[model samples]
Each structure stands twice: as structure tokens, then as C-alpha cells.
Target: DIVKANSREPISNEGDIYALIACCETGAERLSGMMEEFGIDHLDDLADYIIDTSYRGTIEAIAELPKGTWRNVLKVDGYEQEIDLHAALTIAEDRVALDFTGTSGLSNKGINVPLNYATAYSVFALRCIIGPDIPNNAGSLAPFHVTGPKNCILNAQPPAPVAMRHTLGQMTPDLVYGCLSQALPDRVPAEGASCMYDLPLRHTPEAVSRGDEQFALELVFSGGTGARPGLDGLSATAFPSGVWGSQVETTEAVAPVLITRRELRPDSGGPGRTRGGLGQVIEMRSSDNADFMLFLSVERVLNPANGRFGGQAAAPGRIRISRDGPDLPGKGEVRVKAGETLIFETPGGGGFGPPRERDPDDIRRDLDEGLISRQAAHDIYGLEP
Candidate 1:
């Protein structure tokens, strides 16, 4: 019923219909306890059987879309290399499956996505696009499937690099959403921080090696979210993953560096009624002669996340060094040398409506907040400069 209502397909809930999905973590001991708490005889009687049930519902939702509608794009970052992800989206009569069979295997670095986290983000994308109206319940997830073989990056085995699961995990929605755009062109928004600031850094080696010296790490920043149907993308927010932006003072305090300038980029959002999210510029430098290491899990460099309808892609993310130095590597992990300031220009949100249709009054407010420049307000919104 939910699928039919959302996708306009004819799917009825039968008496035998039940959603049963499980993960390796759902052991007998845990299941037994849950059964007792829920007043069920066995673990199977639980409302939802698996932890990654979210992904199951998501795949099912995506499957409800017409055939060949979903396109998958895999983006891999970290460890100074790029892995082009190849993915497939398919659905069975009563169930859906998201197969990442051909993708890369677990790596020495922490790029692996735990099955649960993978399922979490995969379903998040589907919910955002396909089944927004459907309640995220066991019944809503009855029709889909998701699986990647053990030892694969999406389904890593034991002893795999699990420290940075979020790095690759966060990209799954954007990857799947990128495919969704082919079928539902206007439904998708440009990507924002598919992966949040992968600021897994150690204190300056000089300070840390000394064992007594207090050192600062790095302050990774977030930008605006992609614009929604009728709302502007939020500034300095993390979406899809629902993570919060780390406080600048907290970040600076933890590390030996100082955040010089951190502010919203004017006119960074895509122009529209529901404008794309804004971006931000973050400046950081070592207070002393300390060295800092950065685990840069970033994207939107080569392919700035493209916007829907006629909206433009948000600004590409860039890493700038002091003295107008050459562009640094955009993807993977890298180190920041001593005495050089590192600046991160984050990506902006995709536009929801045409720029010209934006309200003049709202444009004025944006200008006041330094979110959009006076020139941009005049040019994009046709307001007086």
C-alpha cells in the first residue's frame, strides 16, 4: 500500500507478508534477550529482525521505481587514491536487493563500511527520494534487499580498517542518489559533504613525540546542505548522516592550531526559491612550528555534485595553502606541512528553484548576514545593488 501510494504501483499487503532481515551481530544471546523484553517466544517474532533493516526498506523503495531508473555511482577517497565504485540496483517480485558485488575489497586503510552503516545510508537515500511519505517501519521495508559480499569494502571482514567507516559510508547515499537522478531528474539535489570532515588527525608529531607538549590537531569544517523542494539548504550543517558541525573553539582547543577565519561563503548556494545550502571557508594555521597530519576523506573536486532541474553544481571543494600556493590533492588522505596555513573551501548546496524567482527581501537578508554579496543579490535576484 505504501509503495503503491508513493510509486503509484499496485502492491498489496498480504497476510503472509513479513519483513525478516538479520545481520551477523544479531546473535542468539542478544536475540533471546530481545524476545524476552518484547514478550515474544523467539527472536524471529521481533518487529524488525535485522539491524540493517533500514537498508532493506531503502532498497525496496528504490526497487519500486520503474525499471532502469536507478543509476549507481561509487566515490572512494582516502589513502591518496581514488576507487571508482561500480554498483547495481535491482528488485525481486516481493523483495529488493542492492548488490555491490563488483566493488573493491577491504583495504589496508579505514575505508570499509560496516554492513549496518552501509544499510543505514543506503536507506537514507531511498527515503529521501522514493518513500518520503512511507513511515520507516518494518512493513515499509518488506519489499527490498541489500547485500555486499564479505571482505568487500561495503562488507568488511574482521580486522579490516574500521576506524574510518564513516568516510566511505557517508558517500553511499550520494552515490545511489546520483543514480536516482537519471530517473527522477528533479528529485535529486546536488551533493554536499558526502563525507564529513575526515579530521582523523594526531597532534603535531613534534609536540606529541615530546609526550608533555600540548598540541592542536585540525579543525575540519562543514558547508551548507543541498537545497530541498521548497527550502533553502541549511548553512554549516551536516545532513543525510545527521552529524553536527564540530565547534570551532573545540576543534582549535583539541589541536595546536588556530582557526583564523571561518564564515559562510556569500552567494555560495545555488540560486532558487529553495536555494541550495551555503558553503564556508575555514582558515587554520599552526600556532607554533608544529606539524599536523590530516586524514582527508573529501570529494566534489573532479565532479562537483550536479544540481537538479536547471540548477548548477555547487562550488567544488578546494584546499588552498598560504601565499596562493598551487591546488592541493582533493581526494584521499594527506599531511599538512609546518608553517603553512591550510584553507578549506567547502561545497555549496544545489538550487531548488530558478535564481530569478528568489524573493528580493530574502536576498537582502542574505546580504546582511554576509551569506550573499551585494553584487550577487543584484545579479542573481535582479535586486538593486
Candidate 2:
């Protein structure tokens, strides 16, 4: 019924419509089954119980926070130069408010973020660390209030280009954590590669004329996660995005490109008491006599993830035609010649504590596994290989 009501608009793509309907139907069926098992005779009663319980839990959680204002500023690789994302978190007994008054103004490019999207991520970050076990519903989210001055990057009005909003939106978690770390130092994690690496591939006109089976493809990849208080960061894991990396076989079956090499880079993770996660390297080339265009939008290029508690920063990321060639910027579109290969090195996570405090046995394990070079082991971890 919901899908039918939403089908008022003209359907330009039947496949997309079918997929949406399937997703909606699956969710509805699950909710109905849960209600039945719980013996929920009245939908209104269940709704009230959920809302009231979540609201009370949210209030109790907010009351635990120290009443004060904490501020943090983050720098991102903008269209032409660096842009700052400023956030001021104010905690009270009843609610929490995030203010972006001092953030940079909206860019002329497509990297601006809308107010609703910004607010959503801001609340999500808070919920992650505060009352994380609580059920997320309308009531649980009602205590968060996000605001930014008009014309700023976090509050861009209509007519502004926001095509790549996620480029900066995903950074909000790190930005918010900056403030929360001051209040709950033990609970927050170090900075990490928060944004996703998305690549769009399209066949060249010549390949199209040759009757290629697949003409377009999109491949998604992730970087390392920041180290935690007592554990090492996850290697090549998706953080805020919660998305899995695409399989090489899956991509090859749909695209006219061959993945030559895909593996973790040695010593990519930052060295510390609790080591950061490791990043990966990917190399690909177009099929014989077939050229393609690639679209790139990634972050942590200019300012890599920052470490915490005297730990070292993670390795920065890069993209290029070859290992020795000039590097490509974080966002742009380029053409790949038939025989030319494109290489991508994702960013690593930030360490949690001082490098010298790391366990020697763990360091030896990394060395034996070829995860770190002997020189890095001696210099970064101060250990003889």
C-alpha cells in the first residue's frame, strides 16, 4: 500500500521501482511479524510505549553529560582550497545542541551540505557514544538540535550545488568526536579515514561501438578505522558508512576492466600502543583497446587522520597513473587509456597511544607477517628486527 501510494509519479525506470517495492515489502513484513509475536493488539499502544520509553531513556542519558560547551574545527580538501568545519557542542540537562556558526561558507562547487543531512549525521555521532544501547526512534532523536548560520557549508540553502555532500558530511563524526573526547576521553577514538572512496567507470565511445556487454560500473572501497582505547583499529574497514567493499569478481563480471592487484599495504597503519588499522592498495586497467573515464571523490588527502594521546598520525592516501607520477587531487574526473593502469592507496587509521609503548611481541608478529618493513619497525617502534 505504501509503495502504491508513492507510485503517483511517472515511472522512468521499472527496475528501480521494483527494487524499491521489494525493499518496502520486506520491511513491512518484518514489522508485522514482530508485532504479532509481541502480542501487540493495538498499534497505537505500541507506538506510545516505544516513544515514551525512548524519550525517557534519552533524557536520562543527556543528564549524565557534563554541562558545558566544547568546540572543534576540522579542515577538508575543498574544491579549490581547504575548508573548515567548525562545531560547538553544548550539553544541558535536557538536550544537546550543535552549532556551526563559525564554519566556512558554502562553496561554489557541489560539496555543500544541507541542513537536514548535517543534522542527521550530527545526531548519529552523538547517539553512537551516548546511550548507544538505547532504541533509536523519534523520541530518542528528539533531544538533539542542530543549527548553522545560513550560507555556511553545513547549512547551504537551495540553488547551491550539493551533489557531493557526503564528501564532508561523513566527516561530522570525527568533528563531533573532537568535542566529546574532551568530556569522555576514554570513550572517544582517534581520527580515521571517515569518507568513502567511490569510483564511477564508463566505457569509451569506441568500446560502445564494439558492442560491449557492460557500459557503466561503480566500485566502492573503504580505508582503515581509527584505533580504540584497548584494541587495534580494523584494517580496510568501513566506519561511518557501514558499507562493504565490492568484490573483485563481482566488478569484473559487470565492467570491462581487469583488477591486477588488490592487497594491504605494508606499514600503512599508524604505530602506537594500540596500532591503527591498515589501508589497502588497488591497481586496475581497462581491457585491450578499450578506454574508460573514471570519477573520483575521496577525503583525508590533505589532512590525514590525526592521532591521540601522543600517538603518530596515519599514512596519507593518494591516487595516480603510476607510483612515481604526479598525484591526482581528491575530487575530479579523468580518462584512462586502454593500456594505462590506475592505482589507489587508501588512508590508514590514527593510533591511540605513544608508539614506544607498543608490545614488542605484537611488533614482531607484524614484522614476521611482512606488515611492516624492518626500517619502520626500528624507527617507528624502536625495536630491532
Candidate 3:
């Protein structure tokens, strides 16, 4: 989301950050002049240096995420294996720095991110929590920088397993945002799912003798995110990593599966004036085949994202297979067969405003949209269904 213009000029803090970015990009001493105007000469000297490092490192990383994945390694076409990622930031002075030199080296997974993509996500995280009102651009990015080890998992070199790169890539935003939060409070949101719960499905049957036909490839859904200030946490919305939801038709047509039931988990959202977004409970099974391998990358099951302010923390996420019946323990990744169904209950977002202060109309609207159950509305928001 873009920041809206305020009625008056942006506060000096905002202007000084922008001026620093502009100077870094233009290589003009004029930015230094602007910094002097704000009593921030230290930032002027560091602006270009920060921008140069962040811009170059981010661009370079962008070029790499897709190229190193298993998809490219396997020689698959049409998937393009290409992604569009960009970076922009806002700095008030010499307060922030982006450093890629300390990041992990390249990996062999198909999910490895081009340095640029990593930069984009990192910037995005900062954007989401730092200065939602600031325009994201090269100038804003000027004061930050990132660095990684020559060949760490985050900084994959080549011939790495990149197919599941986003598994780790998506966390950069939160990681970087964590750093920013130390410098800018009130501006940052709480931590989120970080990992997309993205998984690759394949017919990697337990019995190799059965062959690959029993295996199928596909995608899955995610759980909830951490709560924000005055806003209840969001359930099931991928934050800091907004990969588009896979269309039902697209998913069915591409793989041998169908979504039997997918709906919000009642009372799943944490209580607050702005309650967390509710997570959903999804059930799925194989249509054409029963056997498949769930290659998963998920977090928050053991450690849920923490909430800021007085808001309580949201619940963790979980994935279960229902062959034996009832709540099953979710293995990070598992193999399954026909007749087996997978059930996933994502985490809930933290609450923002006080639950008692929630608008009655908003409660009614959530009930109308199936976001909050009638009971939840009454219990959490003190509104009758």
C-alpha cells in the first residue's frame, strides 16, 4: 500500500530522509546541503555509500533467486522461473544501513532469490513497518544496505537447491524489519508468518516400486500473521511476502487434488479493538491419485509471532493428516496416499485496538463477510450477532 499525502508538508523527519536518498542517487553534494539543513551531516557522508551498496546488492540478488532453483535445474519451461522484485526505502538520517555482505551464500534449491528479489522483500518489510507514509523509491533505499557471506543459503552462488528459495527468502523482510524496529518504534508492525507455508507436492511415493504416477505436484495455503498496533492480527494473509493466492481452478487443473472445505476458523483471531485477521481451516485430498509428497516450509507452529502494545499473541499454525482420524501431528514434510486428507489451521493475527473499543459496525461487517462467527463477534467484540 502507498502512503497517503498529509494535509501539511511532511514532517522534517520525512523530508530529511528523502533528501538523503535523492542525494545518494544523484551523487550531488546538494544532498549534503539538505542534511546540513536538518543538522544531519553524518548521514550525508553515508547516504551514497548506503544507497550504492543496497541498490547494487539488491539488484544482483534479484537476478539470482530464480536462476538457482530446482525448476531451472530440472529444465522446466513456461514457469518462466522469472520474478519481478524491486526495492526502495526511506531514511531520516544516518540511522539505517543495508548490508548484504553478511547474508548466506547461494543454495541448490529452486527457491533461491536473485539478490534483487531479496532486496525488494527486505525493502518491502521495512516499508510495511517503518514508513507506510513514505514513497518507496531509490532515494528511500539510499540509507540502507545488506550483505551476506559469499555462499550462504541466502546468498546462493549456483547449482543450488533454489526451488524452495522463498521458504527462507520471505523471512528477510521480517529479519530486516526487526533491525529497523530497534531504530523506529511506533512505525513497525509486529512479526508475521515470515514463511509462506509454501510447499511443493509430488508423487514421491513411499514405495519406489510404485513409481512416480502416484505422486503429483501442487501448492497449499498458509496460516495467520502477527497483530499490528490497534489492529487485530490478520488470519491467513501472507505479509512481508505477498505471493498471490493460487486460483482454485488453476490448482485443480494443474494437479490431482480438490479443496473439499476451506473456511475461517471461528475465534481464531486474537482479541483486540482491531482483532487479528482470522485464519482458515482447509481440507484437501487427491482426486486422480492418492499418493503424494508434501514438501513443506512453514514456521509459527512452535513459535507464534508476538504482538505489540497490550495485544495478546496469536496462536501458532498446524498441518494434520486425517487418515487415522482426529487432530494429527503435522510433520514439516510428509508422504501421503489416496483416501488421506490434509487439514491445516493457520495462526491468527494479533489484536490492534482494545476489543471493547471495536466498532459495532465493523463487527457486523465481519459477521456478514464470514470473517467472524456470530459467537465470536459477541464474545470478542461484545456485539450481538
For residue 323, give model 2's deviation from the true position in Å. Answer: 2.2
Q: Per-residue error at 317 for model 1, in Å?
A: 1.6
Model 3 TM:
0.61
Error of 1 at 346 (Å): 2.0
lDDT of 2 at 213: 45
Tens digits of per-residue lDDT, candidate 2, 208-269, equal: 46765435656777888888878888888888888788788867755668999998878778
Tens-digit lDDT string for candidate 3 (104-221): 3343346566565666777677545444444556755654565455455456666665666665567666556445444454555656665676556765544356543442444546
Output the lDDT of residue 87, model 1.
61
Instruction: Give the candidates in order of lDDT, highest first.
Output: 2, 1, 3
Name the best candidate (by TM-score): 2
Q: Which candidate, 2 or 3, would have the higher TM-score against the true structure? A: 2
**How much is 97 displaced in model 2, in angstroms?**
1.2
Q: Report every candidate's CA lDDT.
A: 0.66, 0.84, 0.57
Better of 1 and 3 by lDDT: 1
What are the clash counts of all predictions, listed in order? 12, 0, 89
Query: What lDDT tens digits, residue by residue, belong to model 1 across residues 222-277?
Result: 76677765667887677666766656666654456677888887777777766778
Candidate 2 structure lDDT: 0.84
As a TM-score, model 1 comes out at 0.70
